[model samples]
Target: MSRGTIYNKDTFLTNVANQLGRKRQTSSVSLPKWKKSPQYDVFSELSEDALLDEFVKQCEAIHTEVIVTEMKEIQKVCEQVIHDLGGESLVYWEDPRFIKYGIDNVLEKKRETGMDIYEWSSTKGTFNIEKAERANIGLTFSDVTLAESGTVVLFSDKGKGRSVSLLPKTYMAIIPKSTLVPRMTQATDIIHERIKAGEKPPSCINFISGPSNSADIELRLVVGVHGPVRVTYVVIEDE
Candidate 1:
């Protein structure tokens, strides 16, 4: 079977249809309209400011630090986070958004000050993963932020390694205010719309909430077992 092609899908379906003595239905069906769509209704009345407030509240509940600041102060806030986290080395995605949002300045200044910094690069191959493993911090921008769950959605690609957020001791996300949504429902809708418009969706979409935590080990809550121990959200209020 070819890649992306289902192995014997038509034959399997036809066999099942023959057993039922019916023809295979190939027409599309319309979905029933629901009376109540609570998914869309939740936080529907909230203004942008109210959404940010809710996002911050949710972040606090999850033990993630939320630093709300304007665009002009982004570099300063990033520097403060690095200092507070004792980040001697950093790894981040090669996203242009970092440069657009002033995070590039932090990388440049920190590198000048003798702190090691690595950007995810396809050409670097496993070298990116190796550096990310030893790096103290990993930084990236959230494609869509879920205000209700305090989740930062990342669209990872060749230039954006999923391990950039997964392998670091501390994970930081720059969340644009405009990317804030009420919940996962809105986030999926955005992705669905992109697909409907003939756009190629990201290969990997990660919804990270705070830091990694699990209660699977004897029902005891453990942090950083699967990923970063500390998570920080730097919200650009003016964006």
Candidate 2:
């Protein structure tokens, strides 16, 4: 409206008003997000038990083995898995969540197991990953477990580094029952809530649903092409 203005001030004001109106409408709009999304989720209902059952089913479909056990039995299962895999070397994240479950201490008595147990390093490059690549088994504590897709989420940081789960031949994730959610949307909501509460996410958030596999090469399926050949999920109910 200024005198001798080169631009169309009236038109610009009208466009801005339109945008403001849209924003206002958006602010007042509401959608039932908790309800199943027709475009994404297909489940009609999901209870705690239903979620666990669906999660196990999906995991198995992707060649992932889900083992439900008590907290006391977890250590025994990990040791048994090491023996069964003939694992000469093992690696795990140093996250305190795993420590609370005694997973970190499992490797403390490394000499007795006769296997090299390495912790994920914050340092980059070959010096850090050399031990990880040689390890036959890798262990990690998941941030969230999505029941709909059987997905285990891990955020890589100082204690929970990336290589421990990625470079190894086989990967095992220990998930607490409380971390399980009905779907990816619910999991993301919880993450967002954490962020709003001043919890900073790590540099990387890895979602592992099953073993690494591909079928594109010569139209023949192959495992361990991109990452671990086998993936295991050990769910602790009492955690």
Candidate 3:
């Protein structure tokens, strides 16, 4: 049969109409415009110094060692933290200059401390998952915002895979203070902008408010159930 004759003869439309029955008309409600509210500053009350102080206190309260230093001094801190933790150090960076500088600084520190330093290569994506888990510490950058509930948003595409941050026993995220956001909604705005610009979201987007924690079982509090047991945020003040 001809295609048009076959379709008309089959009663397909009738069957579909019967199955669907009558369509209903519904009214649509417009969502409120994205607006910044005064409450956005609630989390911002913690000044840069105050935030660092509170961050250290929080880490110590959970028995995690935190080393606060300028971004330029990160290599030194990384070497020290790795030696002190007694675990092999793994460094991941996407920028070539920073990577070279980091590797050189780490090597120099390694010479003094006898700690092993390994450069993470992006070509080997899955190769480092296990190593990061066994690592004592993981370091990476943050696509920061000042209005994001004092939170840091880390994209796995930034070179530090999500596993590096999530599976490790301790995680140190380096976010510049200028990137600090006042609320979570502002972060959403940033995400929307990227999406609108036709950018794929990263493999993972971690909105880490604090360390991994839970109060799910019988109201007894627990920490690090699904991710790292310890998380230390280093706010890089100088841009």
Candidate 4:
């Protein structure tokens, strides 16, 4: 190198620092303790009814429909929607709650509606998987919902696979009022406690907010491009 263009490592770093207007940080720093602020603990004090009302309002704001129903009227409400959508087939999680709630029996009854209900399980064979994929609607039960975000929390296990929500053209979830929480933080705290108690988390935990949408191509927003185009939550007052 010529004398006029001479440079050392220290000189180069100094010049760069001068241009960037920042001092190089070399010390390892630790983050301060996380103290919960007064406003940080929002939604923990909401009443059950208030939470449900807020949850319904938030869900509708995201283009997701919220259906309020009682435990006894669940089957009727499900049938009404299925008829309205011309839903020929439905795929539901193989959960015992469906039976306990009487939805399974009502759906299984042969009627002129021509609606067939299929139960999804992890051990489903090839034939069953194909049926679920072709089903017109997907139904699953959510354990919790964050009202502020209009988010439904679903954990996939042996009876509940991700495909049940992904494969169908439309998706619906049955949420109980007892499972309603204020926000994700509240839901996560409960999960953390459960883990601390030696409980294994499910393989998949889905926080579904709205219908599947994408604008990756042509800048045109498309709904249900990858998953369901429509999502509905039937919030049952199971109290």
Global CA lDDT of candidate 4, please? 0.81
At residue 18, what lDDT does model 1 achieve? Answer: 88
List per-prediction Cα lDDT, in the order shown: 0.91, 0.78, 0.61, 0.81
Candidate 2 per-residue C-alpha lDDT over 48-136 given as tens digits, one digit per residue, 9 for 90 to 100:
67778888999978899888888888778766666666668888876777668876556665536677877676665465588888889
Model 1: runs farther than 4 Å from truth? 1-9, 12-22, 217-219
Q: Judged by TM-score, which candidate is best? A: 1
Q: Name the TM-score of candidate 2.
A: 0.78
Runs off by more than 4 Å, candidate 3: 1-68, 71-75, 91-97, 100-104, 111-116, 145-150, 198-200
Clashes by residue pair, model 4? none
**Candidate 1 lDDT by residue in tens digits, 171-199:** 99989899999999999999999998998
**lDDT for 201 (candidate 2):** 68
Q: Following a full C-alpha superposition, what root-mean-square deviation does model 2 have from the true structure?
A: 8.1
Where's the lowest-lDDT run of ten residues in candidate 1? 1-10
Give TM per candidate. Answer: 0.91, 0.78, 0.65, 0.78
